[model samples]
Target: MADDRKVALDAALKKIEKNFGKGSIMKLGEKADQKISTIPSGSLALDVA
Candidate 1:
């Protein structure tokens, strides 16, 4: 099971890199960081009613 999951994950990453170009993960992380930085801290809220 673990091996299967690893294989699937690797395949997905390769696909992403192919579609998005090399260093895509690092690019995504940088974009995410920029977007997250814009959000006000402590703004997240969850309601369980």
Candidate 2:
């Protein structure tokens, strides 16, 4: 049930990090608002999306 979902979520996160490189994904509450950083992706649409 919930455990199964957690396992799947963790696996998915790992896969994303593997493909996109580490620090590309963040779990809920894993990031602190005060420490957040932003940079332009060069396209407004891409950045917004």
Q: Candidate 1's error at 32, in angstroms?
A: 16
All candidates: CA RMSD (Å): 8.1, 6.5
Question: Any idea what lDDT model 2 has?
Answer: 0.87
Error of 2 at 37 (Å): 10
Residue range 1-49, candidate 2, lDDT tens digits: 9999999999999999999987788877786335657999999999998
Candidate 1: pairs in clash:
none
* lDDT by residue (tens digit), candidate 1, 10-38: 89989998999776665343544343224
Superposed by TM-score, candidate 2 places the C-alpha of residue 31 at a distance from the truth, in angstroms, of 3.3
The alpha-carbon lDDT assigned to residue 16 of candidate 1 equals: 95
Query: lDDT score, residue 23, model 2?
Result: 79
Clash pairs, candidate 2, are none
For each candidate in the order shown, give its overall lDDT on alpha carbons: 0.67, 0.87
> Which one wins on lDDT?
2
